[model samples]
Each structure stands twice: as structure tokens, then as C-alpha cells.
Target: MQQPASTLATLWQIILRLIEKQGLDAEQFSRELGISAEVLRDPTARLPSRLTDRAFAKAEAVLADPAFALRAAECWHPSNLGIIGFAWLSSRTLHTGLKRMERFSRILGSRFSYRCAMEDRGLRFVYNHGRGDWDVGHAMTDFSLSILVDMCRTNIGHRLEPLEVTLRRPEPADTSPWRDYFGCKVRFGADEDSFLLDGETANAPLPTVNVPLANTFDAILTEQLATVFNDDIVSRCKAFLLRELTSGEPSAAALALALCMSQRSLQRRLAALGLTFQGILDETRHELARRYLDDSSKSVTEITFLLGFSEQSAFTRAFRRWSGMSPTGYRGNSAFAH
Candidate 1:
């Protein structure tokens, strides 16, 4: 299933707030992205992840700012993340709050994933594109880490600074914005994207820490997660596939492994739901192919790689079967339609 609409609203809340703060017209900006002005108001709405991606691109283009993520972080508030934000705020320490964020991160979106773990430096807070891997570009990686720092500053203390920051992307022409914002050593072209904090800083009690309240929110979040995943097997499968697709081509065996089920059982489960694994996989590819084609920055070859096609010709053939046109033709049509 697609990510909940409320998650997209959080992203828009940050982006639109930054736009307003910069003296830009939020409504006009929404129009530029071909979205409704009131899109963020409805909490139950679900939006295509590609729309969120386009909005980020739009903000970057309009503002001509490489520090767009930093600006958005400045405008971020706890409420922007809804229940997960509150659950985080009520945690006993920065480490607990981060753990809460990682647990309930699905409420944010399937497109983004996070990990909070211990590393050689200390407790490392790693944020990347895929949950199990790091394949996303710099724009999203920067925004995620920056806003996380914003969250830390808000809950722990404004003076809080991480031990070190590592990014997978190459260094930009100017690194001052990142260094100034992070207030630490920012390493680029690293093997992974992560933020390292000393053990003391991570485990230290927060000003707003409330164990009882945090427990209450945790219970509620647990219930919500159960309902979301148990409500539909198809949705759970779609979400899993979306995250795993970037690594390589999806297979029934791999999906079964990810879902912690035997191959036969997984197939039985899908058959019971009146669906097939290949059917779901094809649907996912169709949806993602169209979304990627809509992005002008993503060439057909890149989209092919992203969708896990071994060859561009294979992707084109698949696209032809799905859309009755070549990948390039579909992209041209998508551009005109938009």
C-alpha cells in the first residue's frame, strides 16, 4: 500500500512553512507542483511519493538554495510528525526518542527509512533512502539528517551537537552551510549516511522526558501498527517491495524471507487473498515506472536501474507491455499531460 497522506503533510508542512518564511507564495508554489492548495489539511489522504519528491525539487529550483533542507529544519515542529513526534518528545532520553522515531517511522513514509544503533563512535543515528540500505540521493539524505538534528535540538537542548556527520554523496562546492548547521565534522563521500553521538549525550535525560507518557504513546503506536499491517496483506507486501526494490529485482522467495514466511506459505497467503506475487510485483513496477518517468531528472536508464532492471531494453519492453508505448514515449506523454 502507499504511504498515508498525513506523512506527506508533515513534509509539506515543513516545505510550505519554509516557503512562507522566505516571502514566497505557498499557494502558487502548490500550483507549480500541480497539487491542491489544501492538500496538507486532510490527515487521512494518501499521496504518491513522487509528488513529495517533485515538491522538494520544486522548492530547490524556485529558491535556488542548496540549504533548503536546513531552512525546513528551522521551521520544523513536533506536531509536524503527528503521533510519532509526540511519542518521541515523551521519551526519557535522546536515545529513547530516536528509538521511538525508528520504531514508528512507517507513519512517516515507506520511501524513507531510519536506523538507530550503536557504532564505534557511539550511538549512531543512521538515516538513509532504503530501510535496509543507502541508495537515495543527497537531497533527501540531507533533509532527513538535518531535520533530525532539528528534532534533537528541540527536545534535548538547543546547544546539542552530534559527534560527527557522514554523508554518502560527494562534497558540494561549498560545505559551510552543512558545517554551520551541524556544528561538527561533516564527512562527505562516506560509505554510509549517519550521525554519530557520544554515549553520554545520547543517554542523558532530556528536559521534556516523561517515561509514563512515553509508554502511553508507545502503546497507542503499537496498536496503530498492528492495525495497519494486519488489515491487509497486499498493502504490507507493497510497502515491503517499495523499500526493497532499489537493491535488486524482487522475487517471491526474497519477499517471503523479508516477511518471515516460508515460500509456500507466502504463496498460499497471496492466493487466499486472490492475488499472486508476480501480479503484485508487476503492479508495483508499473506504478514506480510511471512515477520515475514523470521525473525529468531521472533518465530512462536511471529509472531502469532504480526499478531493478538488468538492462534498459528489458525495462523498455516491460514498459511497452504495461503502457503500450516505449519508456521514452511514455515520458514524453507524461510531460505533456502534466
Candidate 2:
């Protein structure tokens, strides 16, 4: 996919703090950046990702520092990333935190889809920008990656160094800042951007783990992310479908009402998009099943109903047809494969 249209408002909050610390007024900064003060102040609001990118560029220009991102990214708190941060902090292990991140990262930013794939030796969290070129600039990428690494380190109470840090940006003349911060061989001019975590370190249980707290935050993040993407007809319908799965299969009328539209109009709109309600529901179930399988918290039997399947056998058969494996088998393989 290309970059998401918007990013979480919490990102702007972080940048607001950075700019304020530099003796700039928040309102002034918002005006100067052509961002709205109203939008910047709202916790649930999503700023245009391009606006935040502009802030990054403006910050660099104001500071006259090519490496301003390094300064702005320092000393992140758990609450800085909103619920996503809290969820990660309360996860049972680094692996669990990563699962929460893979699921809920859209709450923070969606420009890059985060994929957590396990290696025999370690875990790889990839920043996949997807096909076609979209420049996020080196500063934004560096700032985001640093916060991620810092968040992991804070959660585990360990200076958990990655096995490697790869970037697409060109090598700077002074590589010491990147090298010293990552505490690894930071590879510039790499094929893609990623962090490689040591398996033993990532899978180890953490003292900060709190399952109930983490689950609570995860649920909120899901609902919040849903509302964030609910502007469009397809997204609104899809969000309703995912929530509907928990109770049982939802009807077209119910989904239409949820979107405040009638069934006939809903069908007409969907048809215009070359989609059918059944097709959308099937796709939603398939995607939700794969996601639910990733979390060790939910059981196989529970996932069946969660996808609105009447029986475990039905779910298994459907899953086999979709993924060519049983739910259990798919769950097991997901840890070892992408």
C-alpha cells in the first residue's frame, strides 16, 4: 500500500512539545505549519500525514540541523504514543508487545504497514512502504524508528539492542549518532527499513507484563482506530462488520443502520464500488481470522465465533480454503513465517 492519508494526533502532540521546548508558541507553530490549532489539540483527531511531514521539514529548517530528528525524538514516555504505548508496555513479552503493535499501530501511524515476522534467530519488524515511490523523508523515518526502539527498551527495562538496523537513506558523513543510538551496525542504503530483534531477548517474559491492562488498551485502540477510518462508506461498512463478528453474523440492514443508511442505498453504493455485502463480509472474516490467530490471548474456539462462524468445523474448513491450513496450524506457522 501507499502511505495512509492521515496519522494519529498524538504524533503532532509529540512534535508540539518539541517545538515548545525550543521557545516557539504552539499556536504559532500550528499557524506557521498551516495546521489547525483545533485539530492539533484534539486527542482523537488525525492530522494529515503530509502536514506532519511538513512540520519535520520546518523543524529541520528552523534549527538549521540536518539531524533535528535526533533531538526531537529523545525521551519518549509510554503515554506519548497514547493507548498503543500503554498496550505495548503492559504486554507479557516483547513478542506480545510486537503483536499488539502490529495490530494497533494504525492508531499511531499507517503510512507504513508494520509486519512482525519471527526468524529462527530473532524477530524482524519491517517498515514496509509498499510499492511505488512515496518519500516520507529521512527525518520522519528516523524519528519514528527511534521512538519505536526507545519504546521497546523502556517496556522491557533493558537496553534491548537490535541485531541490526537497516535504512534506505544514504550514509551520512558522521555515522556516530546513528551508530551510538542504535548500538548496532546501522546499515544505510539498504533495500528496506527494519529492526532485527534477538529472539531470546524478544521472547523473554517481562516484569512489566499486565494482561488485563494490555487487553483493555488494545480494545480501546481497536475502537478508536475504527472511528478514525469510518469516514468512507467501505471503511464504515467494514468496521461495522468486524465489530458485528463478536455477536454473530450481522445482517445487511443492521450494517446499513449502523452507517445510518438504508439497505437499498447501501447495496447501490457498494455496487458502484464493484463490491457486494457478502463479498465484503467474507473478506472481513478472512482478514479478521488471520489477525485473531496472531494473538496468543484468544483461543481457536473463541476465534470461530469471533468470526461469526456457527461451528469450529465450519471455521476450520473455511480457513483451510482461505489459507490452505487449519486455524491452529496457521497460528503456529505465523510465528515462523510472514
Candidate 3:
């Protein structure tokens, strides 16, 4: 199932948290990721979906801690920390909500899986990525951890710091800040990625205002949250365009009919988002071309046909317009640079 774009909001939330923890310059981070700092600050900024993956990976490298991503996710808003997280908090007895989070997280995405268990004196939360783990980059992992932590904290009405934060990647120069914010021992090069919480701290009571209000908020938040993933028409349309671009056959009318919408309405909605079907098509083609050129052993002719180009010359012209170089030249330069 397609996850909501709000998942991206969760990513931005994680980025802000890192800023708070490390005091790293936002502009520098943006430059390192080849994005604009202004976009990072703007909650409504429309990011190219692929860039989210890239940014997270780069940020993880710079921060040197895998949990940095999760920390950022915890601080993201449009959250249900009060509702979804409150049930465990309001229980008369001690209970960990980590498993509950794993259950309901499908409203988020199925790209990753989570498992939680009660340990000897604490709780452990493990994150496992799905197939095409290529997409399971830094940003996604960080956002996942952040949301889980935030949910736990909000449920209990107190900041429940983790006992330990572990990462798959090696430590970065910013490792000290991670330790400071987590207020715990931080480990890198671990067997698996996870966060641990002390059992005593796990059962602590939180300061929530109204348990009843939490129930009401949960319903409201759940409905609003569903909208994030329920728009299948839009996702299908995007997918169709992506697949057809190799045939150079992306068409608004065809996509609209396939989506059971009028072309006019589709165009208007996309316009509101500062995108057009053509722009999406071109961007998809550009991204795919870059990836193929970089990774594949295919000839220029084969790639041109695969991208739906009528001829090599046409593909060359478009490639030059997109990247300011012929495909072969770009590939040569990339190989040389590497």
C-alpha cells in the first residue's frame, strides 16, 4: 500500500530534531544533500519523492549515527501521541505500547517491519526493512524511530529516554550530540538496529490532561491519517506515468480515464501542487535515465528504447537538456569521477 505524503512530514520533523540536537547548520546539511534549506523549513514544501531517500542517506552519513533519523521522526508533528499513544499511558497497569505501534504503523507504510519485546529489565524495538531495501535509506529509518519514541513519550506524558541507541552505520563526527540528546549509551556497528528502554522508566506515569479527550482525538486523527494513504487514484496515476514513460507514452487524458477522473480536475489539482503531468513524466524519465546510465551495462540505443524514445537522437537531445551532456559523456564523466 502507498503511504501518505505526511510520511515526508515525519522526515522533516526528524531533520529539525537533528538540528536541535547537534546544532548543525541547516544550510550546510542542505548543500550536502543537494537540496535547499528553505524547503527543509517549509512544512508544505513539495519534495521530489526520490530526494527524501537521498537526503536521509546523506544526513545519516554526516551524523554518523543511525538513530539520528529516528530521533528526527519522534519530533515530527500531525502526530497522535496523545491518542494512539495514550491508551498504554492511561492503563491502570504497566504496559509497553511498542507492539501496538508496530500493529497500527501500516497507516504509515509497509516498506519496513517492526518488532518489540520485553527484555530482562527493559524493552527493545527492532526495525527490519522490506525488499528493495534500496529505498530503506537514512531518512525513512530515522522517521520510523522518531515516531515510535514520540508515541511512547506522548502516551506516558513524560520524556522517556531510551537506555541505548544502536545503529547499523559507523559513528560520525556528530556522535557526541546523539549521546547528549538520547541521554544514554550509543552504539554503532551493532548486530541489528534498535532502541532499548529501561523497564522502570517504561512503566512511569505521564501527565496527560484528559483520557476521554484522547479517545475522541484518536478517532479524528485516524480519519485524517487515512486520507494520507487512501488516495489510491493519485498513486496509481503516478505509477502509470512512471511505467509508460519508457514508451514515451505519458498522457494526462489516458491517465485521467484510468483513474476515473476528468482531465480538467486532475490538471487543476496537480496545478495546485505546482506540478503538471508533463513535468512529472519528464522528471521521472530524467531520474530513470540517470539511474540506468550510472548503474547499467546497457548500450545507449537500448536505454533510449527502454525510456520510450523513438530514436537515439531524440533521447540524446532530451538527456542533454536534462543534464547538459550526452548519455555516453555523462557516463564517462561519472566513471572518471568515481
Candidate 4:
């Protein structure tokens, strides 16, 4: 399947960093991933998701680190953090930064969603991997949070450790390494995934120079961020698609009207982006179906109805096309397979 433009942009960034750090040329990494070096240079170039998986696998094989992907977080620079980091730096305090993170997190990435709340004596940053695949979602969240913590230290000129780091994966037998890295407590196999911050620590002051300069940086980063399409249109369409699909039926006409565009224009623009209305619908259905199947104990038939399929047969057919097997077969092959 075609990879999303955002995915490609991130892959480009990762490859660039790896090349810079390992003192290897792009040609070498491209040979490992079995792609041309030319293709990697273009930010807009498209590749299959499987290719990315293969590239990371090859990197792991060479690096001899199962956690190579996670370790990639350390390479993230301040500029790569984009608008999120800029906003955090501009904020008056760490508390404000956390609030902005909770509010405008879509600017960070669409794959993961976050929830922040003040508990009895601490602040909990709960992150939900909204992506369908558990492993991918978990990896993204882990890397993102790790980088966020590192950035906090950089911005504040002090190490502000989390009270507890909760993970969805099982606890490894050797916990000492994690304890050393996070500089606090680590809990695994939690009911929900979150990073806990002490209330006092979260309210601490950051050592940012020139708040006005930080604001300027935020604006520049916002404008520089790469997107698959225009931000406003994409955000609106995605929101509408998600809402309509959750209902019994979703229609393109209704969506077009809601977006203040005729159905014909909508189709034309989406086509220009190499997508169709049906493609978006199917993508939404497939993503939601996978999430429900993995995260919930709902029956297949119920999930079909919940995803707005008129009949179980139609849902089953679509599932096969998306996953190369029946819904039951896919579920059986999944990590959360029941």
C-alpha cells in the first residue's frame, strides 16, 4: 500500500540523522533498504510502508539492537520537534507547555493522541496510540515521550524526571537500564499507558532566553512543517470522515456540503492528492476496525455495525481486501488476537 506523505517525511528525517551520525553515505543505507539514494533525497517521494519496515529491520540487523527504533529518539534535534517544541519553549512555564501539548497535539502527529490531567498530587500525561497496530503505536508513543522528556531537560537546564513511566508492554527482566535512563520508577503491564510528573516539577520554570524570539520560532516552525495536504482542509475532512463513519452510514455528498464544497470539487481535489472519497472512507474504516478489534473485546459483527457497515458480509469482504484474510484470520494473527 502507498505510504502517507507524513510517514515519508519522517522516514527522510530519520535516514538523514542516521547517515549523519553513523558517518555512512545515503547510498549505503539506500542499498540496505533496497531503495535508490535519489528517492530518499526527495521529501515528497512516496514509498510503500513495507519498505520502511524493511529498512528498520535491516538497521536493527546491522546495529544488533532490537531497540534501534526506540534509540532513534535520541537523535531528534530541537528543530525536528517542530511547532510542539517551539510552543513549549515560548510558554511561560512547564505547566503551560503541557497544556498546549494536550490541546494542539495533532500538530505533533496523528498516529498518537494524548490526555493530560492533574491528579491528586501529580500531573499524568496519558497517551493513547490511536493507530491500529499495537506495536507501531507503542513504538511511536515511547519514542515521542522519551524525546519530550529529553527536550524538557534541555529547555529547563535541569533534569525533571517523571514520577512513573507506564508502558503497555510487559516489564523486561532487566529493569535496571530503564531505571537508569528515566531516573525514576518504571511500571509495565499497566491498565493504561502514561507518564507521571510530580506537580512541583511540572510547575517549575524553564530557562528560555527571549520569550519573543521563541514565539517567532513557533511561527516559523508552524509554517515549515510538511503536510500531506493543506492543513485546514485535511483536518476538516478527517474530522468529518471520523464522525460520519461512527454513525450508521457515511456519505460523500454530506461531507462535501459540510466542507462548503460541491461533491464534484471535493472529488477533483482529493483526486489531485491521489485519493478518492471511497479511499478515505475505506482507510478510516480499516483503521478503526483494527483498533476496535485489538483494543476491545467486541464481537466481529458488532464491530462491523459500529464501523457503519450495513452487513457483516460487506465488512468481512473489505477486511479481507485490507488484511489479506478474513477478519477472524487477521485477528488470530494479531498480537492482541483473541
The best candidate in terms of lDDT: 2
| TM-score of each model, paired residue for residue | 0.64, 0.73, 0.45, 0.55
lDDT per residue for candidate 4 within 134-204, as digits (tens), equals 55445555556676677667766877788898877567676665666678888877767778887777765
Deviation in Å, model 2, residue 209 alpha carbon: 3.6
Reference-based TM-score, model 2:
0.73
What lDDT does model 1 reach?
0.74
Judged by lDDT relative to the true structure, which candidate is superior, 1 or 3?
Answer: 1
Error of 4 at 254 (Å): 20
When 1 and 2 are scored with TM-score, the better candidate is: 2
RMSD of 2: 4.8
* Candidate 2 per-residue lDDT over residues 244-336, each given as its tens digit: 788888999998888888899999989988999988888778767765665678899998988898999999998898778998888776342
Computed on alpha carbons, the lDDT of every model, listed in order, comes to 0.74, 0.75, 0.59, 0.63
- Candidate 3 segments whose C-alpha is farther than 4 A from its true place: 1-49, 57-100, 129-159, 171-175, 220-338
What's the CA error at residue 202 for candidate 2, in Å? 3.6
Tens-place lDDT digits, model 1, residues 158-197:
7778899998878889989999988999999888889998
In terms of TM-score, the best-performing candidate is 2
* Candidate 1 segments whose C-alpha is farther than 4 A from its true place: 1-6, 131-136, 229-338
